[model samples]
Target: MTSLTDLSKLDDILALDLPAPDAGAIEAARARQNDLTKPPGSLGRLEDLAAFMAGWQGTDRPTIDRAQALVFAGNHGVCAQGVNPFPQAVTALMVANFEAGGAAINQLARTAGADMTVVPLDLDQPTADFTTGPAMTGAECLDAFLKGAQAVDSTANIVILGEMGIGNSTVSAALAHAICGGTAEDWVGRGTGSDEDGRARKADVVARGVEQHGHLSPLEILAALGGREQAAICGAVVAARLARIPVLLDGYICTAAVAPLHGANPAFLDHCLIGHQSAEPGHARLCGAMEKQPILHLGMALGEGTGAALALGVLRGALACHNDMATFAEAGIG
Candidate 1:
């Protein structure tokens, strides 16, 4: 695991040697898939998904014995700019709902057999408004990033990451615009039912933030434009990569949270799969910018890792077919 005591160490960690998939295990899994009692390539992406799991898990027969889901929540001060329809207090309320097992993510996590955890960064202390300056100081950003890294269960077969924050869609748009390079209007979206006027406001806020921060390194952009939960998501992604764990990223906000890491090192997201393409307009563009294909397209805009939790079922099904199905020789079907 990489020690991240200071924000300055982040660049070093991003540049450090990282693990790659096990070629032997991947080859073995592919061979097994070909031998299964079915025509070649009949299983479509299921076969590819199984091989992906095998490579990451370093096993021909990869299993999702322990799937973990993490949802990080924080309040963004940019809500002061009226970028969202809901108040920032909704963030804390949603966190409580998650803990009480009443949110969509709770039900989806339970159905998918994943252990769910909700980590709420200081709800009482929202990040500074990025329109005025950096959203978080270096110390604050590093603390949240470390908290995210610490939340990962290294023993799990996979991790699903999601987030909850009012006005964070604006934060995500700002981060995406800063990292991916586009007009603020291109990245802004209607978050939590923002009206046309609200979206315009959001775009203005994102544009101003990017202008104030200027062009900097990806990690610096994160500290300048990202909220606590966004920083945490980036940290969790790094920790998961270090542990060689596969990851399923939720929708727009979650994807944007780690966009900086991708900017820093594209290989940083090699082990991850986008859980879904959100209804949020910027999500599709962001995924396009990163050249990642999402696993589902249910028009879901909910943020609490709900999309990733639901995609867990698809992964479980793929593993089941890969690990439990009989071969042609064993079934005497050849």
Candidate 2:
């Protein structure tokens, strides 16, 4: 796929012919599942997950030899609205922690045996405050989007996407509300341990952002209400799809970041899976709206792809059972 040079060219990318999962591989995997020593359907979602991976990998036996996790960090000017208790500097500080391998995500990625990459999108220049106008200009949003798309490793069998941005929960709420069409309260959630009052303020800010932007195309909503990290997530999702790499989506912020793409085209998420259900209330509702059932529900809301990284272990287990287990004939059973 050619690199995206302009935001106007995004429509072309969305309209490009995308590959579908291999039906033959899916059938072969299902047959193997039935022939396994275990009783039919006993493994439940594991069985389905194995088939899903097989279909994407185009093989009855698939392995995740290399998995890539991307965490995009950006500062949000929306923090000026008092939506977050933490200062904006926290974003840069946390990025430093990620690089130093001290953050939770670093440990999680290491445990999952996935290579992690952190991309900080102009941390010194936050997106414009959306309550007053568009969060980012076309050029700024396009640049961040390209940064995300370029970060994907084409050799990875699977990709996990996440984001880090102070006051980004409000940006997420605004994006979700603009794309999903509900009261701002439906999308706002206490992020970074916001109290009730802070959540209320977030909701108010989201409401104002949506009102200011009004109804628009999904991409337009992204440019209007999304921050740099949010746009990067969207870009990464598209790049992964183009490369035929299955994706594991992280919690609320990550999900909301790509919600606009789903709004533009539901098929955009066909190769994607929700890693977990976030404790943030809006995430479940957003998942329902997107028709995605999460793989795990540990009540995790921490971003940075932590939940997705943990869920990678689940995928690895599914592949292990699918590829290593003996068939009933081989076991001389049944």
Candidate 3:
């Protein structure tokens, strides 16, 4: 794992100004949104979803267009509380599945012409090939999030973030409570299909974690439960914002992972889209706090970017229509 302390090296990169999305292009896309095949205002929020993506990417051609899914995998210290049904080993095992291209995220990334980048964060026993364990410390987490941001900038112009870990929900709830200032009961949820007993345990664990770490700042909260994957993903989002690359976020854990950075950089919200409303209790609160509209409401609790992967399809279709549709003048129908 890369020591979180090395982040000081990236101070220059983090300070660089990012290019802005074109407002003129966004205005044009908004005009085009009303001109789609459907009646005016008929497609509901999706019309807005597509137009915003197009405008932000500066292309009526906005397509989740070159979508990529980066799965941040790690293990949490809180899982010992019986919060997760799967063993901690599953984080490493499934990462192997992700690398082998057999996981759902792999299939979706393939379908969307999106690359799947597997980032292994600091965990007890990390499988090889994931990014070095995240830099430790809140400063480290911030620096690592910036570094992850730089990695995503290298390839995908637009991206998605997913996570894999046995007890990430526990960490996520704690992070949510810390950053958003809510109770553990408000943020905790069943992760990896926990039973009633497991859910109770998950909530209880998060409550304890919150109370223990509640005094810390956002970065401190991350250092406490910010698994390697969570920290890297947070850094990646910072990098994405710095690069101004649009990011589609998966369920609550992945979204919550970036909280510290979000607090540091509120502009981070302008560069992201929340892909789904997770069944997790705290997800809605987080989304509301971010003011992002989740396109899919599948009650999903699966963290492997399955929800984001699915939502990207709808976003892609919206882009296609915006860029390819023949206007009345072009078709000579008027």
TM-score of each model, in listed order? 0.97, 0.97, 0.86
After superposition, the stretches of candidate 1 with alpha carbons farther than 4 Å from their true spots are 1-8
Tell how far residue 88 is off in model 2, in angstroms.
0.3
Candidate 2 residue lDDT tens string, 1-334: 3445434554555665667899999999999999999998999999999999998989999899999999999998888899989999999999999999999999999999999999999999998899888888876787788889999999999999988999988998888898888899999888998999999999999999999985878888888899999989988988887788999999999999998899999898899999999998999999999999999999898899999999999999999999999999999997
* Candidate 3, 192-239: lDDT as tens digits: 777878777777777666666667656666666566777778767656
lDDT of 1 by residue, 148-261 (tens): 999999999999999999989999999999999979999998889988998899999999999999587898889899999999998899889889999999999999999999
- Top-lDDT candidate index: 1
Error of 1 at 254 (Å): 0.4
- In model 3, pairs of residues that clash are 1-133, 3-135, 4-135, 4-136, 122-228, 145-235, 146-235, 148-236, 149-236, 149-239
Candidate ranking (lDDT, best to worst): 1, 2, 3
The runs of at least 3 residues in candidate 3 whose Cα sits more than 4 Å from the true structure, single-residue gaps closed, are 1-19, 35-38, 63-65, 125-136, 139-143
lDDT of 3 at 271: 76
